[model samples]
Target: MLDIAAELHEWVRQGRDFAVATVVAVDGSAPRGPGATLAVDTGGEAVGSVSGGCVEAAVYELCRQALRDGRTVLAPFGPTADDPFATGLTCGGSIDVLVTPVPRTSPARSLTARALAAAANGRPTALARPLPSADTPEDPRPLLVHPDGAHEGTLGGPPELDRWAAHEAAALLAAGRTGTVPGCPSTGRPALFVESSAAPPRLIVFGAVDVASALVGLGAFLGYRVTVCDARPVFATPARFPAAHEVVVDWPHRYLERTEVDARTVLCVLTHDPKFDVPLLQLALRLPVAYIGAMGSRTTHEDRIRRLRETGVTEHQLKRLRSPIGLDLGARTPQETALSIAAEIVAVLRGGAGPPLTGGRTPIHHDAPGRVRRPELRPPGTARTSPRNR
Candidate 1:
């Protein structure tokens, strides 16, 4: 639904009318989960996908018709009694979609638009839908929450449904995950799809010098919204850290006083100076940031840990810090070191053991664009050659 919400906002912003098709139910081997949405604007532009290309064209035609008629309708496409392949979904399952034409200003449309605006401003939001009682067994209602507590709409149903969703939303906010809740009808279970968004995690590099510059560059490329903080003004110039979103030339601990760190944030102590690193480590070890990595040798790490313990950082708290800052990739150069650090961050965020893809089965992204995107290994500064040519 976050994908649908974002794309629908884009569609309307471009001066187009569109209709959304949502899968309300599925019986058999459906490719997508229920609550899956596909929106097609009047201009034939589409975002979000319903089926695996088998029913997109048909869904587009329906969207065009709905836009013309200004009506909201439910479409059941599958092996119905009259036409099996008429709807183009022949995957031996049924998909019931709520096709709602979005007016320039309608209730659902307004809610989604506000939700998108909140997400754009790095705010958290939730979108809730009331499930049909008779049609499905799963608790069909779900609220989509963002990282900052902003949400789109609500289930407008009984207070019980809303309360259950709010509880789930809090959990989703904490974990930054999206999924469905089942058994909400007093069974204490509900089927829902929850998607969470947080501010792109922070990567604070404590040095503003050469290695810091390389790390900042790599961090930005990896989507960390990098910040470079150093007490030294000469080296912490924006020119030195071009890829950094912020360059702070202030005492590291003092600067952290004004910043908020969450479990999603990463604090990297890159300066080898005890004056900066020790104080910054004090603050970082006390915070809940997911990863506190310091760039130092094994000896430096052990020494720092001992000093931290002396300063009342318990072993439990000190466990959060990752000394040496990256996997043992045997990297020797600045660029290679940056790669190792970025890879470690990725591994942490993904909650994986950094294994090869051959062992993984989860989709690279949930409801990622049907359009082919380049793999993560594409070289920097290289154009992504389209897959169509191959």
Candidate 2:
């Protein structure tokens, strides 16, 4: 799946046949959500995970079986009435997993390689696969949806059903969200389990400072499409920010105004200068972005707040700013500082507190509404990303 695209992409290039198991549904307390993948090559080498650790062995065997038989399968992993110790989730939740084979000769192999390549490189793409069932059609089965209303493959359904499913996947891609929606309408659409994999979210850094480079790298590692913007063309060059997906020389506020953003966008104003920070933060604090953090000392923050207020920024909007960005980890180096800031971004994303978990009674995990969860991430910066997104 796209989560392990870097490795899976290589598997395709080498013409190695493989089977993939994807978590398609969840009932309760499932550690991994829909779209979580566990891929196994013909050689029995595996990458990625479907569950935290509960049902991996069973899922692994299922993938191996799929590779051998070349049959798409949908299996459930949960507590069984006769055997409580069977392959199931220990977290008291149930999940439905779909195992699909990607043989070298199958058209799906090529289609999957394309989706993986696009998603790995931060291009806006989503892969939608219908669960295998009695009415399941033959090969070239999955539907590939792009952000610009373009689609590649088909669900082998009626034209109307394919169009409708592609539309739904496109909407999910626009939001940078992946999950199960109503699948192909195969004769009343029998509630087919659909699983979608979308590109990563956005993390826009509004400064070309030394720390910006580290932040860009970390953001990509955490699965964000990173951008660096500044008004000075001299500072905002690709040579300076090789980690950034794109480097813009336009004014921070001006560039933001013309760009696309959503609820998942993270804005980091690293340009402490009032000329850059004030106007940018004023606009950012009011947008529907996920986090708005500005870099400045306490004195500079107070001055910046005063300037923002003078620009008609209301108290409600000002309350959203996270100045003096990053957690209080006594960080000094740019890498440490970037880690602290990235930690805070994740905290905000997951509704988590900045306190230590040493001896707290607070729930260890907080789930933000509609927040998409996945297994461990494969750092995007370390991979050979396609140049298309750049």
Candidate 3:
């Protein structure tokens, strides 16, 4: 939802008003999960989407009414047994969406502001909002939580209920998944929707040549903070690597020594030379970086593995390396090869097996680059296009 957030920030800065529609709950066979958000502005223009395409026109009308009447609503739209919209969902599932108006200045706006700021700083966050009662149909609770476990709203139940929801919020932030926990009649799960907003992963390229340049550019497009490091001064200049957030002219191992490498970081050795790539691979294998890739051929990879094993990199660590460094897309050029590698990184992030697209039954999470948007099209000059935030 970073796109939505950036759009909202710009709109707020320009003194415009908008409302957000979020899918807060889903039942059997639902398309999108809880926390899918679509924001509609005063003009009716929107960014982000909640559903596939069934109820957007209905939602836009609701957003216009809410803006006009100054009311926020918990709305449900679905196909009845007799309604043509009954084909609303491809999977024939129903969803409950929470449509809340963001006042010029209110708790909701403040919470969104805080979330945008935290995300800009690369901090993880979660937005926790209570589900409207399936029985009562009137009550709703909204909560926002930071990575440190601090919370802003209550779920309108017991103290224990709020505490349990808070713990769930923190856990969701760490896992980077959006879901809900039902409020059991006795156990008190607190029926809440938690949306995880974490910083993008880090992609570090340990080369400064043409292939490294392509990899850096592709990595940035894929939402990674790209860093290019090399010991050579002439090749590692900022002009050659303008898209990279940082260019470090230092020995690869020396630079990695002072850096923080974790499961959220990816290291790619594109030097291809045995002397440069071997030492860096040896050092990178010791860290917890989620993906370690080296650009080389099968023969080169075999030779590199032999050297790594001799240099004390365990077999377990060697398995973590994507030596040929990409999916077998049979990519030939540097740009195509970079695309293959970046696609692999995305597959790793979402825990996908990177299997062939043919007959793939499992749905791909985050269908679009950003979040959801209002499905209907408004007449010109009726609505403004705003971005989405995760």
Candidate 4:
């Protein structure tokens, strides 16, 4: 339900009761994964989606039922013979959904409100809801866990159980993921659905041009806090890139040096000019950003690399730069070019090769390895004072 946090927050503020259906598990080719939510308020209003479109109607009805009865219900939908006519996914997948009523007076409502508020303010927040298990009665009270290891509400299990669940949820929150974890020892089943809503990743676009404007829109749509920076004040205006979260009139390198970027950040240098590109490329290559692509032709790329190498950038660092920016999509317009760049960014993040998936041997989804310790959890540009800092 954290996906529709803003709407849920407003609903709670207005004392409006609602029901939420969250996907707790999936099998086969389910369109939506765990943590996908479909919420319906008392007024028959809805926000968010649990399935791509297949089982929304059925989930909506389940939500309404939960709202009317003020009871939590676990509804399983699949292509199986059981309740086939009631709800079946055409994608040949199965999903278990937990529909819970969120009355204004319930502790769940208050916990959800706090989680939503934290997410709205760009804070790392997680919501842990106890799913029903055969061994023990499910705890209806959801726990709101923050990055600092503090939590509100409780699972009503042993204190150690809550701590264990909170620790696991914190690990998932650090990775900006949402999914289920094994239940606490008392529950004896995988009963906790940890939904993490980390702050949006950063997208810093250097050089405010037509392509930059298109990229800003695409980046924002992809849930990035996009910033368009350029030294030329006339070119870098909020009017040109209305979708960007911020537009800065500053040198790209200087701005990047001072900005709060993390390993999840994506830097796109579109300035093409050596004065702006070289210094920025040097700094970006050394950082641990997820993507660093510079827009230029092959000749310009070679020239930029030569300059970067001259300025003490190592061969290993230069390899991280993706110059001649995007995939070869034969894009001729600014919007199409932006799409190509966005596609490349997504490909990099998901460890996908920018190639046709048809009849390909590559797995559609890459299984990410175990989480690695991050240098710091604080926002970029903040000092890494933690003892764990590398």
Candidate 5:
């Protein structure tokens, strides 16, 4: 899986034979979504998780079998008795897993190798394989689709079918999701499973405070490429924030104005000073970043709003800023405050309300769109570099 690409890539480079079991489909409340993979080498070494801890042992055995037989299999696990020996998910959901062998000499091996390499290098890629359904014919080969309209492997289907699948996979790659798409009707396939490996989302914290250190650590743990920026060099040192991918010593506003950001980027303003917060909030609110939060009390937030309005920030743009920064978790320590902030950021990105999930009507997993809509910030006829270009 892309999550463990570094380890898997090393295994492939060492000429080790392995088998990968991927969840291609899910029904009801599955613990893991589609594209969760569990890989096992011939020597029984394993990495990654397919179904949390519910069916790992069963899946591992399936991988070992696939490696020995050099055959691909589709195994379904659910609450029913479909699979006599198959482990059932306790969460009352059903999932269909595809177990495939990746021997060094197989065509699938080359495709897997290419995908792992791309993921290791932080390149966006999609791996599309045919699901083994009753109505679908056998398709052992998988295709690797890249962002530049390039692809590897062949489905042995019509050229049109391949093009259609590539387009579908590309869309998923852009959205940073892994799921199944309807197969080509003309090709008589039931469905295709697209596993997307996109670059990690970015979290840019614009203060070198104690909270920033905790935030950078938690952001990295959540698979974000974090950057800590501040005008003060004494506080923004690498020794203070070692978890950050980059510690930038510059004005927060100026750094953000020149740095690249996309729809998935989160900008956190921890600099409570009016001199730093006002200008930074001015530029960040107008940008297309997914989240923009600033730390301050309610009274301070009101004052910051007046300053921002004085600087010509529009009312609509002002709504974009999440002042007071985090959810009301009664947090006092820097670590607990960091957790509250991270929780709010995730709630915004996942379209969740910061409330108890105990008896809520909200879906556990929000269905994200096919592609993240880019913000239209530039004026008409003004050309700006696209986020995907970065």
Candidate 6:
């Protein structure tokens, strides 16, 4: 699955056979949504997760068995009121997991490798496969779709059906979504699990301070393509923020004015200086970005708001700014502060707060309707124990 693309990319490169189980569909209150994966290698090593610790052992063995038998297995987990034997997920929701094997000699290996490599390297790609039904019950094969409507491989069906699926998949790839798409009605077929992915979201940090360096690594870890911009060339060097994908030595506002951003971009104004942050926030708040967080103290935030009011920024745009950014984690050091900021960014995007989960009866998983975000790409370790790459 694209969720564990970095690890699976390595597996394909090394020619190590493995079976990966993906949560293709969810009904009710499941822990993970579609595209979540759990993979097991030939040596019983595993990476990633598909549930909240429930049904994992069963899924793990399912992956292992898939590797041995070279068969595609569609297993269902979770408790249903009508079923007597429900082994996992007591939380009233169920998940349908599809396990596919990519052995060294399997026919699916080449296409699987191309998808994994594209996702791991932050390229746009879509992997579309059909779900089984009583009417059409052939073993689903992958069809790799690209943004330009180009595609490779086949769905083991009619050519027109494959073309229709590719067209739908290219549309989803535009939004970086991963989920089931309605099949071509002309063919009277329904449902193809289309997991489409695009380039990772952008995280632009406006300041080359020490916290900027620390936050760059955290942003990259969170799977954002990070860019550190500062006017000072000496500070905004590649050596300072080595983890960042780009380091630009230009005024923050000037650079942002020319840069391309979208709904998934995150703007972090770490330079609390009125000269830099004020002009930057003036431009950032008006842009269509997911988050606009500025680092400052409460008193500094108040002063900054006053300055923005004088600059003719509308109240609606001002309301979008999160000055004194980050959660109240009592963060002291640079790393802790970066973590707090990252947590707040995630919370804002996921519609969550910084409250402890133990006291709350709310569902643990939050499924943003009509929007599916691909999980972060975590590279696997060579260690045989503690195998999960997350």
lDDT of 3 by residue, 55-80 (tens): 66666766777677766566655444
Off by over 4 Å in 4: 42-44, 68-71, 79-86, 120-123, 184-191, 357-390
Off by over 4 Å in 3: 1-3, 10-17, 24-35, 51-54, 65-87, 90-96, 104-109, 116-124, 134-139, 157-160, 353-390
> TM-scores across all candidates?
0.70, 0.77, 0.78, 0.83, 0.85, 0.81
- Name the 10 consecutive residues with the lowest summed lDDT in model 2: 381-390
Residues 1-390 of candidate 4 have per-residue lDDT tens digits of 887788888888888999989987765567877778889998899999998887788789888888888877666666634444545676666677878889886767777888988776667899988776454454377888988777888777678777877887888897788877754344443457788999888999999988999999999999999999999999999999999999999999999999998878999999899999998988889897889999999999999989998999999998899889998899999999999999999888877788898988665554334422212112367431211121
Candidate-wise lDDT, in order: 0.65, 0.79, 0.71, 0.81, 0.82, 0.83
How do the residues 168-265 of candidate 5 rate in per-residue lDDT, one tens digit apiece? 78888876778878654455654778888988888999999999999999999999999999999989899999899999999999999999998889
Instruction: Summing lDDT over every window of 10 consecutive residues in candidate 6, give the lowest-scoring window.
Output: 381-390
Candidate 6 regions exceeding 4 Å error are 6-18, 27-31, 40-48, 64-71, 79-86, 90-93, 103-108, 156-160, 182-187, 309-312, 372-390
Stronger candidate by TM-score (1 vs 4): 4
Candidate closer to the true structure by TM-score (higher is better), 1 or 2: 2
User: Where does candidate 1 have its weakest 10-residue lDDT segment?
Assistant: 368-377
Off by over 4 Å in 5: 80-86, 134-137, 186-190, 358-390
Candidate 4, residue 23: how far the Cα is off, in Å: 1.9
Q: In model 1, where do residues sit more than 4 Å from their true spots? A: 4-7, 20-38, 48-106, 130-154, 174-176, 187-190, 357-390
User: lDDT of candidate 3 vs native?
Assistant: 0.71
Best by lDDT: 6
Clashes of each: 19, 0, 18, 1, 0, 0
Cα lDDT tens digits for candidate 6, 1-390: 998999999988887999989988776688888889999999998999999687788889888888888877667665634444545676777777878888888777899899999999988999987765544444567889999989999877678777888998898887677887655446665577788779888999999998898999999999899999999998999998999999999999999999999888999999999999888888888898899999999999999999998998999999899879999999999999999999999988877777888989776666653564322111254221111210
Please rank every candidate by lDDT, starting with the best: 6, 5, 4, 2, 3, 1
